[model samples]
Target: MEVNPLNIFFVKSDSKGDRLLFRYPYTTENKDESKQKKYGRHNPYAINSTEDLLQNPQSQTSNICKGQLSGFTDEMLSTLFAVKAELCNRKFELKVNDVRFVGHPTLLPYRTNKDDTATMILINIVFALQASASHSVVKCYYDLSKRLGKALRHEEKRCSYLTEEMKIMLAAHDEVSVLDSEMNGDNDDDDDNLRHSVSSATYSSENGADSSPKSAFHLILQRSSLARSMKSVFEELSSTGIVQVRINKWVLLSFCLPHKAHQIHNRGLIIEPETIDKCLQKLRPYHGILLMVNPNELLASIPLDSSSALLRLIKLYSPLKSLQTLAIEADLTLKQVSQLTGHLVYWAKATVIYPLCESNVYVVAPGANVHINSPLVEEFAKEFPGLCLLQ
Candidate 1:
């Protein structure tokens, strides 16, 4: 299943107020052009286009323009900040119209150089998903956000990585503001130099080049390890189910979307050791084993030490041979073979059955699906061309 996030935002709060530290896919200069194409000029939230709101007053209160931070309005930001106490140290889901905000708010204790005591800082890494997202997909993104939040908290506690990165981001924000003002004035030469510096810094940072502190403001922000991590989490986890990111160049953290319970039902099975042992002991030497799954697939998941033995067992396995004879041929003790069979059964890889004999009675399993329209019927017909399933 595809689990793509519309946008990602890192919000931080302290005694001052809530601040949007950084967001992925930075707001471009052509935001207005793209906004028109995406939401159309009729969107109430579109930049400088108020006709939609004037025409439909209800939409002004209900609908939000889509794309990046366009949907994230001041009202939503205030609501999030007002519930800071409830949002801290827990998972939060805030829905506004068609957008759903999911995040794990983490509270970290930070200390400054002058002060020996620590102050609490609330940080949340949020993913914006469509409200129509499936429960499983939402859960996956939530898990990813939770892991990322915890990792940042750990890094902040260990080395003040988050604190330092935020400072750099704030500085970059200030630099952008100054540049905007300068560009507004008639200084064509200065504007060209600033543009060149921004592009060069961005390219250098993206290519893993070491950028100095005095580099362009864009470089300072994108050069942050935390920023790169946020980008990686959004892009990688959405495309693939797994993500591995290095934190502050010191620790490597890995997170993955867990498989649903039904996909790994055998792993969840609980059987008493006494019952398993009794079942193993009751197995007759004349009984044969049948593999339910491909041996090659099982070999990939099993340990290397046991893989060779398993392969040998598969090569020697035969429904016509007694358990004792099969074990002898496979160069395995009868007890060892019985133990192996028990493990396979526990994993739902194989099952024990009687050898083929005319005297043996066969019947459909009680839980088997006997419907004529069942896919099993088609498979059976394909396997046996002339056989009549009803007969």
Candidate 2:
């Protein structure tokens, strides 16, 4: 059914001017007279959507213009102008330009005629109306679009001014683990490790009523860097559990936090490795999740007592194996990653999920459609293969 375009503008409350909307559809038309003949403001306007935006496309305009334009909102104005535009060409909707943010709406219809034109036009009473370049919804949409465009350009300029490090880190946050053209260095570790290390800088005490599981992990890593290195890592891990594990460059220096074993014995996260001979054992029957918040102490090679804890970690892990959502921080060798992965399948038995990695892209975008360009994580994916399948 072809409804009069004017009906779209004049709603039930026309006298009150409850509706005020502005719309303009633009097509790229060359200013050159020669080219203009080939491509005038006709079909394929070079816009993404041609259909009427059911909800306000210029929602900000609608919101800003409501009750402000001669008491009409942007929506109402759009309807009115759409009707007027269709009047001349049923298929044509007026596309205006140069509109802007109005602190207070000004209904400056640019229609030409005597002032008496508006006075005579009572929907029931037929007559012409005076107008101006800035009067109708067509003009309003044009003006608003221009204003929005300028604001967007300003924002792009501001983002472009970001420091190189900020740009890299922020961009790296997206497309984190995917191997792509941006990668440049040797990827010795997996994306899982890269994401953890990069994300570590963002931790803060949040406002959740209870400390979330994520916070627990983040808080642990936020400890002093000493606690992150292998020697100190063992020192910190023991405080959390009874196994006082020691580490060396190639192997561990010690294992079993002799002081905390009773606690682990109490909690059953592990079966305390009480003796040098018994502790040298490789497996245990302990049960629970081994939340390896930071494994800087996890040496390249396992020490004697280390086996007992590893066994306990494994035994405790059997049930948690189904939770393969593993997260690790710190650069590690493929060999080191292999040891950890082996245990996940052999012990925890969990299916890994979510790839977390790094991006090395230069910028998110100038103003919009911004995306990430993680480089480190991408390297890890390429270097380590399926190691980060669960990242």
Candidate 3:
């Protein structure tokens, strides 16, 4: 099953006064001050912009019960519980400073010590669940436009830096998505991240809703915001725990694609048989690409673009082909090959020949062609015979 990217926020209460400092970029939009003061009996404070959490981190005496937290819907809690249960069942071992899954080095300061905060709790949850699960990991996707609008009012320079960081993050995610499709051939079909406003709101409702006594007094968040990046969120969460720390040294580098990338990182149109035929008809006037389809030989059609070296690579493609093998055949780096394959699979709607075994020597087709007597592969071969299959 596919899991949507997880968004977790940690807020610390102000030690100095009744006001709370938002460790995360909490939203103040769609909130009416006067009406809230009249109906809710209190005026909502503007989101705190201070970066230093130590100045006023939440303490035991802090009044966090006064609607400081929100967005804890039943669905979200159920998912979190399910994740936790799975980790326990698997007996997955995790430590507070475990940095195996996290890409950024300096983004995490708990490597040497521990901090008693919601940030540590959520991080452990995300990391342990990811380690235990086979097909999901937590991800953060931000909407730059909305974030800039909110940040511009408070800090211009910080907003500018954030913009650049987001660009790099998006690019990195896209790259990972492409690589995942090529390697795993898994189809991720959920679009939970891009749906709706994706914002969590704070609400104070009646008592009978939760099992915990504190639930009635605690603030409830409905959803998460797209205004802050994962890095930003983590930084703020650790603000109180770590002192005088600068996250400038942390930089995200290219890494192995996660299991969730295949579904979320799709591009190009999935062509139907009729559409394939129409594309073939358009290509009838050309002679460079040849089309041949045969199932008896256990080989699909040979639809090779006559002029493209990349197409030639696919025609003779095998996952077993080493870097040396590729180099001997064509002057292409691994990155170049990966980029080309990404275009072919995602943009061209090519079939991926997934490995059926651990050694990757045995291979099988997609679920649509799982059964031996299934006609899907033959029909697929007939439509566009020379299309490349990812292995």
* Candidates in descending TM-score order: 1, 3, 2
lDDT of 3 by residue, 1-391 (tens): 2222222322111221111111232333212342355456443775746679658765343212222323333233223323222232122222222111211111111111134231111111122122222322322111211222233222323333332333333333343334334323344444422221121111113234432212211222111122233334344322311111122332221121222223323322223324333443332111121111222221232232233656555555554454335444666655555444444433232333332236646435343343545665566567768852321
The alpha-carbon deviation from the true structure for residue 382 of candidate 2, after best TM-score superposition, in angstroms, is 73
Against the reference, the lDDT scores of all candidates come to: 0.65, 0.29, 0.30
> Over 4 Å off in model 3, which ranges?
1-4, 8-159, 163-257, 261-324, 331-379, 382-391
lDDT of 2 by residue, 116-203 (tens): 2321111110101112222332332223223322332333234321122122322332322222212323354667457444443333
Model 2's alpha-carbon lDDT is 0.29
**Pairing residues by index, what is the TM-score of model 1?**
0.53
Query: For residue 315, what is the lDDT in candidate 3?
Result: 59
Model 2 / residue 305 / CA error / Å: 76
Per-prediction TM-score, please? 0.53, 0.14, 0.25
lDDT-superior candidate, 2 or 3: 3
As for TM-score, the candidate ahead, 1 or 2, is: 1
Clash pairs, model 1 backbone: none
Which 10-residue span in candidate 1 carries the lowest summed lDDT? 258-267
Top TM-score prediction, candidate number: 1
